[model samples]
Structure formats: structure tokens, C-alpha cells
Target: MVTDRRSEFEATLTRTAEARGQEAGAALQRASLLRDAIHRFIRNRAAVVAAVAFVVMVGFVILTPWLSHGSAYGVDFAQAYKSPSWAHPFGTDEFGRDLLVRTALGGRVSIAIGFAATIAIMIVGILYGAISGFAGGRIDDMLMRFLDALYGLPYLPFAIITLAIFGTVNFWTMVVALTIASWFTTARVMRGQIITLKENDYVRAANALGARWYRVLFRHLLPNTLGVILIFVFLELPGVVLGEAFLSFIGLGISPPKASWGTLAQDGYSAYEAHPYIIIIPSLAIAWLILSAFFVADGLRDALDPRTRET
Candidate 1:
């Protein structure tokens, strides 16, 4: 009887231990899922760096007007063309204006233009492409052909002609010029994505169920293509900023009294011999902005690409 009781007790203990083992295994699985999510995010170091840089730069630019000492437009011929010194950090420009102040304010214009042009470009591209791609057949061909014709026009030549005809490159004019040329690339990308997505099983099911065309495209297609669109937006921003600069440099960008990085660089060119800081400072700002954008874009590419998803 003693031996039988001992065996029974051992069996009960074994069952309890087995139950505890199962509970521990379940806990481990939960922890593993959490770990996997964290690992996925941490794996993309480039993206993290880019994101951080962008945030810092953006914060700096937003606070620029308040951070400057003298007015961006305030001129002092007395301090004209001063080199970098304690009184003038980035020195004075040809017109005796503070280079640092102007550069700081210039950040607002450059960043604003980038965001404005991109938003406009994306809106037009997404709408036109979504419609054309959903319609398909002759409608798609016709729309694409029209876009192709527009694309064939040289951007520089057209910009020059418009500037000459307008006789002034104002803020709105710059936006218009950029908008005309920028949307084509986005439209093409969106259309291609839409084309592939329309034939997807879910899309087909939605169609079969008599779902509205707009609903199908906007609700289903747009979300899937969002990653691609975001990637393109980051990739294309530098180009827009550079284009704005080019126009400003050539006297076809923002008019004087309204400083842009490009126009500022142009202004500093004549006095670069005496005030190297004037040129160097603006040039460096532009470089940093472009480089930061590129880094953020690269990071987005890695993060968004399916091939690198596992990494």
C-alpha cells in the first residue's frame, strides 16, 4: 500500500510539471512575437538616422525667423561684405545684410517650396493616374499619350520661355512651372501600380460585388500603393529644391527681397571674392538639405522594399 501511494503522488507531480511547462512555452511564444516586431524596426539603421536628421533640420527651419538677430531683409552697408567674425557669424553679404540671418530665413522658403510643389505634384499624379489606370483601354491610351506629349517638352526651355513671357519669376509662377513638369513622373508610377493592382483577386472580387469604381480605387488601390508614393515623394523632393534653386540662380526664380537658397547663392557669386562666407554659408545649407533628403530617401527605400523586409 505504501509503494502504491508513492507511485500515485509521483504521477500527480509529473502532471503538474507538464502543465507548468506548457504555460512557460506559451509565454516564450508571446515574447518572441514582440521581439520579432522590434527587430524588424531596428534592422533599418539608415532609415532611423535619416528620420532623425530630417526631424532636426525641420525643427531648425521652423524656428528660423525667431532665432535670427537682425532682420533677414535688414541691410547695413556699413557692415557690407564683412568676413566671418565674432560680430557676424556667417559675415555680411554684398549689400551689408547678415548672411546668417538671410540663410536662416531662406530655409523657410526652400522647405516651403519643396513641400508645396511635392503636394501639388502628388495630388495631380495620384488622381490622374488612378482614373486613367482604372478606366484602362482607349481612355488610358489617350491620357497617357497626352502626358507623353507634355513630357516631351523640355523643362528648362519651357521655364525660360514662361519666365521671359511673364517677365517675372514670382512665388506662384515658380510653383506653376514646377507643377507643370513634376506630375508626369508620379502619374506614370501611380498608373503602373494601379494597372497591376486592378487585376488583383480582391479588386476583382470587389468589382464582381458591384463595388463603385471610385470606392475600389481609393479604398483598395491607394493604400497598397501608398508606400510607393511616399518613397517617390522623398526621392523627388531634392530635384524640386534643386530646380527652384536653378531658376533662382538664373534670375528666373524668386525675385529679389524674397530670398531663396538659389537666388542667395547667385547674389553671393559676385562678391564671393571678398565675402567667401556669403557664398560658402548658403552653399553649405543647400548641400546639407540635399544630403539629408537623400539619406532619408535611401532609408525609406530600404525600409519599404519587400526584398529587404526580412532584414
Candidate 2:
């Protein structure tokens, strides 16, 4: 038996050697920045867990219709106001719609709005902030003053007033309202970061080399600020989701049959005294997701920040 084992080991080693001999040697490749970031991100256990949880919840939302009664919009007079039970896990709404289905659908809409608004914010905010910071002097002064003026205005009231002026609301309108309200901080943060980076030697060198200001900002500065930007994205998503919910709750957001979490919460609120689960379930879903987003943001900040790497 020992002799057979030795022979098998020798055969395995021989096979390995032959395979290596058959393969051509190549130059070692330099590590990529993106690869390094991925490695660092994976190493952050909290971030990974949060991201996994978030993904699973999203998957659950996507698959809920298939997994359950499979009808988000279908009203069943039979199941009206039913509490958590084997048939309907999340209970039913006043319209006899499945609460589980409605909540999942609401989550989808809420998450979509959050991401959409974030994208809008990132585009306008990053550009506005970068330009403001890079230009400095009078242009920066003017922009900063304008932003400050916008800041002093009562925010939610302004949004409510704007929505009222329009007289009718929908998903797109809600997203636009949220984006318009929420992008100020991102711009301010980006401007501050760009201002700090503007005087750096590399930025000056890029400018001296006749590289366009935009090119320098995009290529050299943005990459360096990516860590902060990504962290901001995670942190901002929850706020946007909550804001959409708030607007919808107040009837200033997506109206009628198109339900977001806010609308569901509003619908749930009326009967909550009698059937608490209807409201509680959607509320918990929102809270859990927002908390998960915060955890991801915190983890990303710690993992991605070069300044924090040494610690």
C-alpha cells in the first residue's frame, strides 16, 4: 500500500512537471488598479456582508412574485385585511392586494428611484463641483454663492410647492424632484475635494503640459476621489429612497396605482391601528435596506481610503 502511494505521488509530480514543460513562460503582468480595489473591497468583511444582504433583498424583491402568489397588482376581495398567515406572509391591503407583493413592488420602485436620482446627482453634482473647484476665483465665488442661496431656501417645503404647481405627479417627476433637492451636498463635497486637489503638483503639471482642464480633472483628479465618491453613493441611496417615500407619503410623489414604498406606507398607515403588520412589514423593509446601505458605505469608506490603509 505504501509503495502504491509513493508511485501515485511520483506519477502526479511527473504529470505536473510535464504540463509545466509543455506551457510557454510569459512575462509577469503588473497589477491593475481596479483589481487592487476589488481585492481591497472583498477584504472588507462588513462591506461584503452588507453588499450580499442588499443583493439578496433585491433578488428577493425581483423573485417575490414567482415565489409567492405571483400577483402584485391583482386584487382579491377574499384576502382583504388578512394578517400574516401561511397563505399571505406579509398580509393584505385595503384593496385586497397582497401586502408581500405590494411591498416587494414598492421596494423595486423605491430602489429604482434611489439609483436613478443618485445617477442624476452624480452627473450634475460631479460636474458642477469639479468645475467650481477647478475654476476657483470669481467663477467659484459665483457658483458657491448660488449654491448657498439655494441652500438657505426651505428644502422639503420648496419640493412640496413645486409638486403642487405641477398639479399631478408620477415616477419620473418624483425622481427629478428628489435629484434636484438632494444633489447639493454631493456638489459641495466634490467642490471641497477638488479645491484641495487643485493645487497638487500633478494637477499643476497636467495644466502645464497643455492638457485641457476637463481632461486633467477627469483623468487625474476623479480617480483619486473615486473612493469618496463611491462611499457617497452608498450613503446617498438610502436618503433618496427615504425622500421618495416621504414625498409619496405626503401625496406629492408617485400617485395612484403605481405604488412606491412611500405610497404603500401611506396606504398602510390608515389601517395600521387595526392591522399593524400591513404597515410594519413595509416599514421594516425600508429600515433594513437603509441600514444595510449605511453599513456598505462605512465599509467602502474604510476599505477604499488610502489614508486609512496604514491603520
Best lDDT goes to which candidate? 2
- Model 2: residues with Cα > 4 Å off, grouped in runs: 1-40
Relative to the true structure, how large is the alpha-carbon lDDT of every model?
Answer: 0.77, 0.79
Candidate 2 structure quality by residue, lDDT tens digits, 112-157:
9899989898888898999999899999999999999989877677
Q: What is the TM-score of each candidate against the true structure?
A: 0.83, 0.85
lDDT of 2 at 299: 83
RMSD in order of candidates: 12.3, 14.1
For residues 175-264, what per-residue lDDT tens digits would candidate 1 score against the true structure?
767777788889988999999988876667567556789888887678778767877788778778888888888777676787988888
- Weakest 10 consecutive residues of candidate 2 by summed lDDT: 22-31
